[model samples]
Target: MFFSKQWITGAGLALALLGGTPAWSADPAATTTAAPVAAAAAAAPAAAASAPASLDARVQDLKGDVIRLNRDLLVLEEELLFPASTQVALFVSMDVGKLFELDSVQIKLDDKLVTNYLYTPLEVQALHRGGVQRIYLGNLKAGKHEIVAFFTGKGPHERDYKRGTTIKFDKSTEPKYIELRIKDSQAKLQPEFEVKVWQ
Candidate 1:
């Protein structure tokens, strides 16, 4: 008595078979009302099973595209290292006051430590009033560079910071200083960065 849509349809088919219903009747004169009902009743559950399988296949296809995008971002990061002077820009923002502080910036070349700054920590009032900070890395050789930026303020919240956006410099004239900002108390910030080559 385990009655379900699937089980009910299956039972109906079993009964039809046991009664010797010809699945394909060539007899042009033989006609019955049971045949059409049997066909439709068999189709409903089969359609239900087919729909979920098709949907699952589509979802898996989308996941494959997402995985490819992540791989592309990785490749872009690797491509950024080489010698060049260029313009670099970084936009940083925070969600809360505590996460915003001054003088927490560092730049590294090819994993070798280049320079870092100890910024003056701003008061909560100052940040709310809108403060901006900029750092400049000038005359870089064509190679890979890493910039690490974060607040040096004491606390677990202060440890959160943005990773360096890697860059490769060719001969060109671009801006040097990058501008980054920290917004509010969310203990997290992402700085937008741009780099260009200089002649």
Candidate 2:
């Protein structure tokens, strides 16, 4: 008979499931009166079953606690690995981009190709709905550098369109952040892209 461990440990508890000790164990009191022994015998199985249920609920709660702790540790690890001081980040946004359907974006720093990203249909929908996208994150020396970004998408009358914009800025000891913004030019009836640096 493979009895559960919780049932064994409950022997010393208030219920005294097996009348002070388990039946198989050596105990002088094992030969108790029939009435009290019969009552203990009936109560033992119910107590044993309930004990495991409570223990299983506690185990489940502990698993939840461990999962939450793991997530917190991961967040702390990311901050330690990519501290704000040396981090350079770039984000892309739009201001009522009525004339452009974005397809992709390419970034270059100091004439070196850094990253090229292609947008999905849902990503384009998110951007048009005023969501900002982080285009790049990297470190750079504290000096002057040039950044170039290429925009490729469909233009007016479903025409193929491509354009490039550039900026010259000085990276200081602090972190650098740049926003690539695409805005609708109501006067020209076209989309205009610009790179704006955080002051």
Candidate 3:
């Protein structure tokens, strides 16, 4: 059905050749002329084997486009809400979390608790697979600030553990990025958590 235009064009061309010729008085010549047109018409059925023109396929393509557009809009909204000049973001990552199993994390900015997050099993699994999760996002004025993070989880030997780490960072006019990286220390037989400030 999609080859309607091609078929019409081929048929129209054959009709024009059969009708508009001044020397079509010979039956042999007319047969020779119709042979190539018949061959072209026979090939038109191959269009049925091409890619789909179904409604479901078009709807699926539209859905994929909408998802990408929504992600872009969300990123734009975040930039507007937390402008880069004053934005401060904290992220958590795990590099082979063998010695510690993360349960929750509490962040304190300038001795005041700002954000606390409890990780689900799915989130922990995502981090174990080399995914980084953004735990906190806020704005800070241009000055020196201290960030204290309390990590509570299961330590070595399946013992309950809570460890606190601090980092003093100078907040400039640029956006500040801090990463709480938890990596296994095979040599020391423990997990090491550090606050890394991105320049």
Best by lDDT: 3
Q: lDDT of all the models against the reference? A: 0.51, 0.85, 0.89
Task: List residue ranges in candidate 1 displaced over 4 A.
Answer: 1-96, 100-103, 121-128, 142-144, 155-172, 184-199
Model 2 residue 95 lDDT score: 87
- Model 3 error, position 16 (Å): 35
lDDT of 2: 0.85
**Model 3, range 100-196, lDDT digits (tens) per residue?**
9999999999999998899999999999999998989999999999999999999999999898899999999999999999989999998888989
* Better structure of 2 and 3 per lDDT: 3
User: Each prediction's TM-score against the native?
Assistant: 0.32, 0.68, 0.69
Q: What total of clashing residue pairs does each candidate reach? A: 31, 0, 0
Taking all chains together, the TM-score of candidate 2 against the true structure is: 0.68
Global lDDT of model 3: 0.89
